[model samples]
Target: MFTPSYHDGVIQHLITDVSEDDFNVAVGGQVEIIGWLYQYYNTEPKDRAFKKKKYLESDIPAVTQLFTPDWIVKYMVENSLGRYWIDVLQAKEDPRSSREIAEDFGWQYFMPEAEQSDQISVQTNADSLSQADIEDVTLIDAAMGSGHILIYAFEVFMQIYEREGYSRRDAAKLIVQKNIYGLDIDTRAFQLAYFSLMMKARGANRRFLTLDIRPNVFDVPESGELTSADFQELLQSEDEAKQLDYLLDQFRYGNEYGSLIQLDKSVDWSMITRISNQELDEGQLSLSSIVLTESQDKLREICAVGKILSRQFTIGAMNPPYMGSGKMDSILGKYVKKHFPNSKSDLFAVFMERLRSLTDTNGYYAMITQHAWMFLSSFEKLRSVLKADTLINMAHLGTRAFEEIGGEVVQSTTFVFKHQTIANYIGTYERLVNFDSQQKKEQAYLAAVKNTDVDYLYRTNQANFAKIPGMPIAYWASANLIHDFEVGTRMDELVDAKVGLQTGDNSKFLRIWYEVDNKKISFRSVNLSESVKSQKKWFPCNKGGAYRKWFGNYDYVINWKNDGHEIKNFNWPNGKQRSVVRNPSYYFREAITWSDITSGSFSLRYREPGSIHDHKGMSAFSKDHELLIMILAILNTPVGDHIFKILNPTVSLEVGNFKSFPVIKNKTIEDKSFNISRKLVQYCKEDWNTFETSWDFTSHPLLTHIADDNLSHCRSPVG
Candidate 1:
C-alpha cells in the first residue's frame, strides 16, 4: 500500500521503498493529489508520522505555485477555441446544409473542407495576397505551454464532432491528429501532452490509436522498412538539398537547443546497476542519449512537415511569447535585421514571418501579442510596411493574458492579418500607412490652407490630412497698420529727456505714516518745528509704521529732531538741499508720497493711473503727454481686443515662467502689446529736422475712430 505524509498543508510521499505498483498508481491517477495538502505530504512522506503531523499543522502561505484553476481554463477555452471548433465543423459539412444548420443554430456556416484547407494554405503565403482577404482567420497556438490551448482545442473539437454525428471516441482521436499540434522546450511538458492526448483517446476503439499515431510517430520499422531517406530520394534533385538543409537546421535548433541542453543541465549523469548483456543490447543507446537525439530529430522533422503543410493549409493562429524590445541584444538584433529586413522582425515579428511563409495567397494569420507595436515610434516604420502589405484587424486586451502567472506586466492586442486581398478593411490602415503614399498625397490637397495680409502672411495645413482627405481653407489678416510707425527706435530715441534715480533698498529707505489725531490729512513742501503744540502727535516712523521715534536736534538744516536725540530727514526732488521753511506745523499734517522715475516710468505711469509722482516739478510737454495717454486708452479699445484675440490666442497677461505655449500661436509677428505706447514715445523725441512732425492728437483718425466706436458701443447697452 502507498502512504503519504502532509507538511505545511502539502501532501508528500511517506514510503522510502518504491515498487512498480506505486509508479502505476501515480501515473494511472489512482491516488491523486487533490489539493495543496495532498501535494506537500505526497512529496515529503519519509519523515516520522508525528513530525509530518506537526508540519501539516502549520499554516499555508497565501500564495502557492500551482496549476491554473480549471474554471479559468474553461472560460478561455470556450471563448477562443470554442469559436474555432464551430468553424471547422461547418467547413466539413455540405455548404448548403451547413448554412441551413447555422441559420437554425444562429452560427456562421463554414466553407467546404477542401476550400477551407486551400484558403488557409494560400493565406499563409505573403506574395499572392493583399491585406484584406485573410483578416478573419488565424493559426492556432503552435508552441503552447502546458498544453492548455491544445487541450482546450480538443474539447471544443469534441463538442462540434458530437453535433456532427461522430461519437466522443472517434472524435477524440481525429481531433488529436488533425485539429491540434503542440511543441514545448520541456520534456515534462511533452510527456504531459502525450498523456493528455491519451486520456482524451480513452473512449475510442483501440484501433483508433494505430491511426492517430501513424503519420508522425517514428519508431524503428521492420529491417527493410522505408525511412526519411526514401522520401528525400523521391523529390527532385534540385529540391533535395534545400529540404535536407531545412530538416537539419530544425534538428539542430528546435529540439537540440530547446530540450536536450535543458535536460542535461538539470539531471545528474551518474547512476546505478546494469542488467544482463542481452537486455543492454536490446536498449542500444542509454535512455538519455536516445531521448536527446530522438527529440531533436523529431523537431526537425516537424518543421519540415510544417513547410509541407503550408502548401495545404494557410490560416494560422498563435499566442507567441511576449518579450520586450529592450531584451533584444546585439546578436538577435543583427540576425533579425539581416534575414527579416522587410518584416518588423522582433520575436513576434519572426513568428509572423514564419506563419506568412507557411501560408499561400489569401491565407490568414492571427496572434495575441504586446500592444506596444501599435503606437510606439520605434515601430512606426514597421507599421507602415504592414499597412502597405497586409490588412490588419486588431483588438486590444488590456492586461497580461495569464493573470495568475507572475511574469512581466504587459498590455496585449490581438492582430488578424490576411495575406492578400484587393481591398483594405481595417480602420487603422490610414494611421499605419506611410505619409508618402498616394492616399496621403490626396489627403494633403484637401487639408492645405493659405492666408496672407500686411501684418501677417502665412499658410496652415494639417500634417495628416492626406490620410483623411478634405478641402483646404483660406484666411486673411488686415494689412500693416504699424507700417506708419517707425520700427527700430529705442526708448532713448523716443524721449526728448530722461532721468534715473536709485531708491536705495526702497523697503528700508521708504517712510510709512498713518494719521491718528485728524480725520483728514494734507501734504506740502515745509518742515515741522518741535515748538508746535501738535508736535506730540507726530512720530518719526519706520517699516510700515511699526517703529517710531521722538525728534531731536540732528542735521537741522536738511534733518531735524522733535525730542533731544532722535533724527528725522526730509526727501528732496533731486537729492539736493533746497528748502524754504523750517516749521509749518499746520501744513505738515500728512505724509508725502515719493516716486522713482527710472527708464520706462513715463510709459508705465501713463498706462496705470495711480503711478505718478506729485512733487516732481519736471513734467512732460502737454502735447506729448496727451498723445501717450490717448495711445494707452486706444490699446484698451474693442478693435485692439479683436485684433489681439485673433493673433495671440494663447497669450495670458499673468506673469510667470512661460511654458506650454501652443505651437501655432508663437508664429504670429504682430503680438507685441506695447507697440502703440512705444510709437507715441518715438513721436515725442523728434528733433524737427531729423524726425517727422508729431501729429496733433485731434489729427489721428484711427485713434479717434476707435475711441468714438468704443464710446458708442458702451452706451448702446445702457438702459
Candidate 2:
C-alpha cells in the first residue's frame, strides 16, 4: 500500500501503505497518470532548456489508463495482422496456407523465420486456411502506443480461435499472453497495452474471477524498478560524464545546447533508488522526467526490438513518430547519422531503412507518412532509393486525415510495400482523390507511374479507385519578336549609347517629389527631353507653383535633345562638368512593336518595356513609333496573353492598369475587305504559326492567322 501525493499539477510521489487498488485508483482514472504523462510529454516548454526539446515516456512507471482511438486500432488490426505480422517478423508460414499460394501467384507474402529455415511456404487461396491454423499466427505491435493496434489484433485473433471450436475465454487468454506482443516508448502506453489486452481477453467473461487472474507475461513496474537503478548507475559512470561532455560540446558547436541542457551537473542521483523503491511498492509520482528519459532510451529499445523480431516473430506494425528535419537537434541528428545514416538524410529515408532492416526479404511493410517526400525536391535522394528497392501500392488521402490537428491542407499518401518477386499487386488500381468537407474531387490529372504501365481509369464518385492520365500542357510564345532577334547578337552591336545619372540623394529627392503637396510637383520636375515648350512642361515643377522652390537649389539639370543631326545634343547645367562620354556608346533605349522582329534574349524587355534597338538601316521615326503602338497593342491582345502564358504561366496577368486595344471587325485593303493592315496581317500570321508549332496545337492556320491579325490592329491610346 502507498499514500499518493497529488501536487504541482502532478502525482508527485506515493508514501508507503498504499494498496494495489489505491495505486490503480491514483493512476487509472479519467485523469490517469498515462494521460498526465502524455500531457507532460507533449507540453511545450517555456524556458530555453526545453523549448524545442522532445521527450519520450518509456522510462516512467507502467500505467494502463492510456489508449489510442478505437478506429485506428481496428484499421491496423485488419490490415496488419496474421501474415502481415509474420511479414514484419520475417517468419516462415505453413506451405499449405493461402499465404504461400498468394505469394506464388504474385500476391504479397509475409512469413517470419523464412530466412533462418531456408524454406518458405506460401498460400495462394484465402479459403485454404482453417480457423485453427489462422489462430496459430502470432502478431506484435513493436511500438504499440496505448495498445490500440495490439488489442485490436487480439480481438481479431480471438474471433478466429472461437470459430475453431475453442471457448472464447480460453482463446482470448491465449491471444493475450501468447499470440500478441506489444512494446512502447511510453511506460504508460505499455501498461495500457497490457491492460487492454487483458480487457480484450476477459470480454463478456469479466464476471468469472478465474478469467480475471493477473498474468505475469508483461510487467512494467510502477516506477520502472528494473531500469531506474541501471540508468542512474550508468549516469554516474565516468564514461557517461565523458559522453556528456562530448555531447555538450557537440551541442554547443551545433547550436543545440541552449535549448536541451540546463546545467553541467548530472541527473538527480537520489531519485533513482527512491523511484525503484516506489516501483516495488507500486508508488505514484509525476513520472514526467522518468517518462522522458525512457522515451529517449526507447530509440535504442526499438532498435533492440527490431533485432529481436528479426529473430522471433513474423508480422509487426507501428505508427512511428512523424518528425520533420527542422525539429532535429544536433545530438539527435548526430545519433541518427551515426546509427541510421540512410534515415538521417531524410525522414522518409530513415523509415525506408528501418523497414528494410525489420522486414524479411519476402515480407511486407506499410505506413502512413508525410507525402512531401513523394514530390518535394529535398527528398529526391530518398525517392530514388525507394524507387530502386520496392514498388509502392499507394492511396493518397487529402487534407481531411489531420483536420483536427490544425494541419495544413497538405496531401498525404499511404504506401504499401511487399518484398516479393512480382512487379505489382493484383487488386484494383489506385487513384488520388481529395476529400473535401462535403464531397470528394478526383485529381486524375496528377496521376503518374514509375516502371510499370498504368491504365487510365475514371470514377464519378470517391468510393472507387481509378487511374487518370497526365493533364495536357498548353504552351505559346513567351516573349516579343525582339527576343527572337537578340538571341544571337553580340553586345557591342546591340547597344548604341549609354547615359549615367544620379539623384544626388535618391531618398531625399524622392521625398521632395512624393511628400510635398500636389503643387510641389512643378518644382521637382526636371527637363529630361528636348524642346523649350516640352522642357517647360516637362520640368513643370520649376515653372511656377509651390514645387518650384524645391528644385531651385539643384546644382545641375540633365537633358537630352534629338537635334536631327549626326550627334544628338546633351546639355548639363551651366556650373556642372560632364562625366566621361564614350564613342559608340554601349547601350541605348528605343521603342519596339509586335511587327518588328527581335531576338528572344530581348524577353528581358518584357519586364522593362524598353529595348536597345540595334538594326542599322531602319528609319527611327517610322519603326520606333509604330513599334511602341504595336508593342502596347500586342501586350493587350491574346498574343500577349500567349506570350505571358509561355514565360510566366504561374503569374496572373490581370494585375495593374494598362491601355487595351478594342476589337475591330474589319479594315478595307484595296477593293477587298481585309480585316487588318497587310503588315499587321503578316505579323499576326507569323505569331499564330509560331504558337501552333511551339505548342503542337492542331488548328486551322488561316483562322488562327486572321484572329491574331485583327487582334494586333486593335489599339487604344495610352494615357
Point out where model 1 deviates above 4 Å: 1-140, 203-246, 255-314, 325-334, 342-345, 388-393, 405-409, 422-719
In the range 1-719, model 1's lDDT, one tens digit per residue, is 23354432212332233344533422322121122223243333323322332212111111111233232333334433333343344444434533344344332211111112343333232332232221223334443434544554455556566766887766766666555555444344445555555654664445665664622212111112222343332234544444434444433333212211111111111110010001212465676555444443443444433333334234455555433334444533445566555443445655555555544455455555555454433444455545433433333332433333333344444545655542323222111111332333223322321111212222222122112111001112223322212232222232322111123333432223232322211122233442232344233221111111111111001112242122223346786533332222322222211112111111122311111121221112122544334334333345533433222212221101011111121212223434554454344323211322211122333334566657666446656
lDDT over C-alpha atoms for residue 239 of model 2? 57
* Candidate 2 Cα misplacement greater than 4 A, ranges: 1-73, 82-136, 204-312, 345-349, 384-392, 407-410, 424-432, 437-719
Q: Locate the minimum summed-lDDT window of 10 residues in model 1.
A: 269-278
RMSD of 2: 18.5
lDDT of each: 0.34, 0.36
* Candidate with the greatest lDDT versus the true structure: 2
List RMSD in Å for every model shown. 26.1, 18.5
Candidate 2 has its poorest 10 consecutive residues by lDDT at 463-472
Top-TM-score candidate index: 2
Q: Give the number of colliding residue pairs in candidate 2.
A: 56
lDDT of 2 at 105: 28
Task: Give a tens-digit lDDT track for model 2, residues 39-117.
Answer: 3453332122234344223211122122333333333344445445333222334435434433442222221111111
TM-score of 2: 0.41
